[model samples]
Target: MGNYRFILSGGGTGGHIYPAIAIANELKRRYPDAEFLFVGAKDKMEMEKVPNAGYEIEGLWISGLQRKLTWKNMMFPLKLISSLIKAGKIVRRFKPDVAIGTGGFASGPLLQRATKKGVPCLLQEQNSYAGITNKLLADKAKRICVAYDNMEKFFPKEKIVKTGNPVRADLVNLICSKEEALTFFGLDPAKKTVLILGGSLGARRINQLVESKLDFFATHDVQLLWQCGKLYLTDYEKYDSNTVKVKAFLNRMDYAYTAADFIISRAGAGSVSELCLVGKPVVFIPSPNVAEDHQTKNAEALVARDAALMIKEKELDSEFEAKFSGLMKSVQDQERLGGNMKKMALPKATEQIVDEIEKLLK
Candidate 1:
């Protein structure tokens, strides 16, 4: 156990990448002398993000099967073969004691190879519904750590551990006090602030809703920190008024969360976990564009519990204003939403995950 060696594989999207890194960071903190390696899809976001996170990474030539029947399907077999060969080589060379998979095509071949090497492989599943890669690796996974409960439906009951997903360290650590957060974002300390996030890539539908409702926000004296993602429809300054601040990405999410009185966002699992930590009154506008329509399912799981509110991506353009405005008008209702959400927070997910990894090694 003192000679700890670990491998982590996940990513294609930030949802998978960030959690994988969060788990890795925790493990590193626990075992500072441990050797760590990341296996990720070639040319994907993880290729860049993993390196930026200060870890060594090996890339596998893997991508998800295209949803539609297309020429891309023809390349799947070749990519599968190439990825397996690459994955096997990486596993054999690193000789990891334990392997962790978050979710993504890259994780499939890598974890499969690790299992073949008789390494202890643990799978961390972030969604309420299991992902395709996690499903494929289920039989090989020695332990399964999941964010949602009742996942015996997805994995062997014996392997399931109801450990929550690892959220970003910076997020769980409040970076700014309320007054500092208010001034940093240029929001009025006296006025309630609304934060709008649409993932790191941004959601077109959510961005459009905010664009149309700028004047409506001013009417309420509500300040906004709108994360428009990269698909900024128009110059942010063009849409800028006294009440709205629009940016492609919000690097200082902690401050945004601190200043926000209410929030609107797509219900990607990572964001959901972070919100549970922040516990702000939120209106989740789940993106219908995701694989398996999982975002909607994630939002519904919370909305059904009366912990949060949800709107459809299709309905966001139509219903967001009416619903959000109604919620914002009621201070008591807002407090209730915030309090219920806070009750759901698994602030120790990172610590719990690290403990599990330590137990596995022991």
Candidate 2:
């Protein structure tokens, strides 16, 4: 077997970070002796998460270019220069066989340096619309793994590989019984269950909508396994009822997926992949505060194929309650969405991506 060493760079949100971790796991499964080096923004979530996943990481002093021109923009040039130097140092020392960029600020410097050193570099962009960082790295990226098509608008059409996003393996075949799942969460299996998720860090808009509508849930006999995000507990806790349980995170995500009949979530790429694998009816509230409004675009891609439903963030106040109520009552609609979504799921993408990496190493 060829010596397999990799540098994985990505961070910011779970959308970018989790896919990087999933790819690393696939690499480990394919080549037991493979060594990995993770690169992330110094103060970002990746610093904590990468170590938790059992990988060593180097941090770069990098941050996104601010949307609004604040004092933060003044520090941008200095950070960029320092990060580039740090990236070069890491690449030289590690001498990776391949460098993978999943999508975040840290990826820009690391992938650029790796490509400059003649290492094979791959970039996996999760959104339908390309972000500024990924767009900048596209020219240097030898192959671009993507979840959406028509990306010719962003990257070279020939370099794009539609591998879909990698998801948790347990979610693919969640064969756990409903009774076991409900018991794990201490919920009533006899009642309808709704799972509320707003990405890993949580979306403020979604948490607000769920809190406003909590009292209405009892009317339909739906119990909520509400994941309000650690950031929004103050607002969400005020609405807690016997029928609704609030949590910052769900450790046993398998139980949450297996127990819920319906889900309300942000349309992140990682979440989209997991929802499809779970095969549950979902209502996507795409967070507009995100870059390029890509979440809405991601939801539309599925909605066009009858695989999901989407509601815009601005319209949530006027529409979410009525729309959610109607969907809850329509068993036929739920079944249609679930079936089409499951049909669209790419359960083998994890294996397929690993296979590609193996071929490269061999």
Candidate 3:
């Protein structure tokens, strides 16, 4: 039991990669002698992130097919074939007790090969709408763990498990106090502070929206702690001031969540899950450019339940100000939204997913 080996594959975005890491971490804690390896697309973010998380990873020459005709689409067949062969070799070499996929391009080939080799495979789908990768591998997956309900529409009903999405450990148990969080970021606690997140790479339109509203925030006696992402720091850093703190990235999300009176963010599945645990009033601006438009679907699920508010990317110009201003003006709305959102928190998601993985080993 203690010497179990596991292989995990997920990548491209933090949504997929973080869940895989969270699951691996739980497995490591449960089985200290467990060997773990990760497979990811060669040039994707997972290549760097997995190693930084203290796991060995193999990279495959794989990427998703583009909808429109492109050079990458032309290369898909060759890459998929190359990845399948490499994945098969890895599955044979590692001899893992369980294979886990968190739904990404690399996971497509890796988990497919693992299942074909008779390795028990588990898939985690983060969105309300199932990803194409997960759906394609569903028939062979021993279990399909998901964050949203009605996922049976995508996966075999027998294999579907509503385990929710795994969130980072720090976010699950916030240790910082509001005063300390404000002090750490050098912000005044007297003014209402809104934390703006555009994801790890940043959102261009979200950044633009924030820039246009800086004067509006100031007029309302509010301050801003904006995590504009590393990619957009050069473009948006000029707006940094006493009333506005523009950071390239936030290393201390616990502190950021603690200090915020409100939050504005992109509605990536990972962000949505973390926000549920954080339980703050959030305005989700989902990116329209995702697979199946899942980000909007993620936000809408919460919005439908009165757990959060959503403004689509296209409607941001027309709706953001009115929606945001109205929310800001109401304390009861904040409390209600925050309370309902907390009710949706699945803090034990990682542990539960690991429970499924553990069962596979038996």
Candidate 4:
């Protein structure tokens, strides 16, 4: 095999960025001599995150169009034109063997340019509902790798592949023991740990719910290992004590997953996939603010299988405490839910996606 060159374009959120990173890491493992280039939107998190993950990345001048007509929305066409030109230049210079897109606005221009240059492109859609960009690019994609089934509703049936979403390597098979994980987080071994995740930017409703329920959690003799995200960390930090450990982010997710007896998380596709692999009983509080309300649909998929529990944002105030209390009181229910969730995990997702890329390379 020759030294292959690969281009990955995705970003705007961790859901998109992390999957692209995972795929790159797997591809690198298979072809150590291979060169990788990442393209993401300028001023987005991927510019910093992809570099931190040890890769070179180029930024395109692009942003998603806002729903309301505003100054940013007015500039959308100009940005798209600029990004397409820049993306075309990058593709011409890079001459990649294959281009992989993990579903983001940046990937739209880059993959479109790559396809125009006769480069094979693979699109990975993490959500049950396909992204607008992926749907638009589906016609030219050599393959559409997805986490959810029924993607034929969005992409060409012949091109769709259910390879699942790629999660962080550390989360796949947690080597850290529960004891070790507890120590890593400085969490109490005596109390049952309830790990709370509100996404990287934090969810305001989730934060408010957690804050209101602190006393209830204390009463149940459960300790909180909360990742409230950076935006709300300052506001939530004052409540941190022996029972509640609040963090802006959980850099060591392996430890966080291992230490928890149960989890409360937002229902982002990346989070759902990671939680399934972790095999813990989880309560999903999906953000209603997301495009297409896809988060709710993601959670519902798990709930329908009896693999996890979900409380919609609108129902959280009325249903959360009762649902949580019921879950807390039933040890049998926890084990059953955890076992079922594990059965749904596609642990080898990254490897499978790379396998498709390898085929394209040949």
| Best candidate according to TM-score | 3
What TM value does model 1 have? 0.96
Q: Report the CA-based lDDT of candidate 3 relative to the real structure.
A: 0.93
Model 2: CA > 4 A from native? none
Candidate 2 lDDT over 1-362, as tens digits, reads 63489899999988889889999998887778888999999999999999999999999999998889988899999999999999999999999999999999999999999999998888888888888889999998888888877888999998888888888888878989999999888898789999999876777888878777867888788999999888888867776666788888898888899999999999989888888888889999998888888899999999998999898988888888788888888999999999998887888876776666655552
lDDT (Cα) of model 4: 0.93
Q: Name the regions of candidate 4 deviating beyond 4 angstroms.
A: none
Q: What is the total number of backbone clashes in candidate 4? A: 0
Q: Write the per-residue lDDT of candidate 4 for residues 259-287, one digit (tens) a residue.
A: 99989999999999999999999999999
Q: Can you rank all candidates by TM-score, best first? A: 3, 4, 1, 2
Q: Please give the CA lDDT of all the candidate structures.
A: 0.86, 0.88, 0.93, 0.93
lDDT of 1 at 307: 78
* Clashing residue pairs found in predicted model 3: none
Question: For candidate 4, what is the TM-score?
Answer: 0.97
**Tens digits of per-residue lDDT for model 1, 1-362:** 45589999999999899888998888888778889999999889999998999999988888889989988789999999999999999999888989999999999999998899899889999998899999989998888988887789889999888778788788877867999987887777888888999888778777778878888888888888888887773645477555778778888888889989889988989999999999889999888877888888888888876779998866666677788888988888888888888888888987887777777784
Estimate the lDDT of model 2: 0.88
Rank candidates by lDDT, best first: 3, 4, 2, 1
Error of 4 at 247 (Å): 1.4
The list of candidate 1 runs beyond 4 A from truth reads none
